[model samples]
Each structure stands twice: as C-alpha cells, then as structure tokens.
Target: MEFDGKTFLTALGLAFILEGLPYFLLAERMPTVLRFLSERPAPELRRLGLTAILAGLAVVALVRW
Candidate 1:
C-alpha cells in the first residue's frame, strides 16, 4: 500500500517503451495500422480499450500478489 517512487517510475518507463515500440519498429506499416484503427467505430474502440485495461490489470495483480 505504501508509495514506492522508483518502482512506479520504472513501471511507467517500461509502459512508455512498450507503447512506442510498435511505431518505432513498424515505421512503414504504422500508417496502415493507424488508418485501420481510425476507421473502427467508437463503441468497438471502447470495448477494445476496456479489454486491454482488464488484461493489463490481471497481469499486474498476478505479478504484485
């Protein structure tokens, strides 16, 4: 329950790396991938976002437990 600044920052930095890797590694395909995502309906995007959040939470819970 206590705040740990270093651990928090490390996790945040890892998240940034994970989020940026696809765009950095797939420089060419990113435009097409982004175009496909842009065309998705709002509800669909919301569902996908929720699914990702839940999955990420599950992993974090397992790791921290």
Candidate 2:
C-alpha cells in the first residue's frame, strides 16, 4: 500500500487522539500509573515498549495487506 502525506498525517493525528484519551479520561489515575511505570526496571520497560511496537506493526501489516 502506498501512503500519501495526508493519509500519514491523519493516521498520526488519530494515534495522538487515542493515546491522549486515557490521560484525558483518567486524569486522577495518571499519577498512580506513572508511579507504577517509574518503578519498573529499565529492561522490562524496554521489552514492553518493543512488544507494543511489534503489536502495532503486526496490526498495520494486517490492515495494509
């Protein structure tokens, strides 16, 4: 699938909206979540981030295919 500038921007905007929704709705719980994340080991956080990236890539690949 080929991407155009507009499509890329739209996807980025949508991602931003989805990412922000939790913080917007759960403003009170954000600090607790942040604290929990802060306490996690760096390696664990790195693995978690890598997993998220892989999951996102899988979804995008499926959708694009």
Candidate 3:
C-alpha cells in the first residue's frame, strides 16, 4: 500500500490519545505507578520495553498482511 500523510497522522493521533488515557483516567494512582516503575531494575525495564515493541510490530505486521 502507498504511504498516506493523513492515515499516518490519524494513527499518530490515536496513539497519543491511548498514551494519555491512563494518565487522565488514573491521575491519582499514576504517581505511585510511576514510582514503582522507576524503582525497577534497568534490565527488567529494558525487557518490558522490548516486549512492547515486539508486540506492536507484530500487530502492525498482521494488519498489513
């Protein structure tokens, strides 16, 4: 499929909304959650991040296929 600026922008906007939703809905608990994450080991965080990246890529690949 051809690249489209509007579709790209829409996807980015949706990502932003999803990223912000947790913070907006759980404003009070966010600080504690952030602190918990901050205290996690670097290796663990890296693994979690890598997992998320792979999961997102898999979803995109499935959608494109």
Candidate 4:
C-alpha cells in the first residue's frame, strides 16, 4: 500500500484524543491511578506495556488485512 500522510495524521490525531479522554473525563481519579501504576515493579510495567503493544499490533494487522 502507498504511504498516505493524511491517513497517518488522522490516526495520530485519533490516538491523541483517545489518550487524553481518560484524563479529561477522570481528572480526579487519574492522579491516584497514575500513582498506583508508578508504584508497580519495573517488570510488571514492562509486561503490561508489551501486552498493550501486541494488542495494538493485532488490531492494526486485522484492520489492514
């Protein structure tokens, strides 16, 4: 498939909106949630992050297929 700048930008913008939505809607609880995450062990955080990455990749692959 050809590279499409517009599509890329649109996806990036959507991602930013999704990323910010929780903070915007849960402004009060976010700090507590963040603190909890911060206290987690490094390996636990890495495993969580890796899971998210794999899930994202699977979604993208399925969408593009």
Q: What is the C-alpha lDDT of each candidate?
A: 0.98, 0.96, 0.97, 0.97
- Expressed as tens digits, the lDDT of each residue in 1-65 for candidate 1 is 89999999999999999999999999999999999999999999999999999999999999989
The ten-residue window of minimal lDDT in model 3 covers 1-10
For residues 1-65, write the lDDT of model 2, one tens digit per residue: 67699988999999999999989999999999999999999999999999999999999999989
Candidate 1: residue 62 lDDT (0-100):
100
RMSD in Å for candidate 4, one decimal? 1.1
Residue pairs that clash (backbone atoms under 3 angstroms), model 2: none
Candidate 4 lDDT over residue span 1-65, tens digit each: 79999999999999999999999999999999999999999999999999999999999999989
lDDT of 3 by residue, 1-65 (tens): 79999999999999999999989999999999999999999999999999999999999999999
Q: Cα lDDT for residue 49, model 1?
A: 99
TM-score of each: 0.93, 0.89, 0.86, 0.90
In lDDT terms, how accurate is model 2? 0.96
| Candidate 4 pairs with clashing backbones | none
Candidate 4 TM-score versus the reference: 0.90
The list of candidate 4 runs beyond 4 A from truth reads none
Model 1: lowest-lDDT 10 consecutive positions: 55-64
> Which scores better on TM-score, 1 or 4?
1
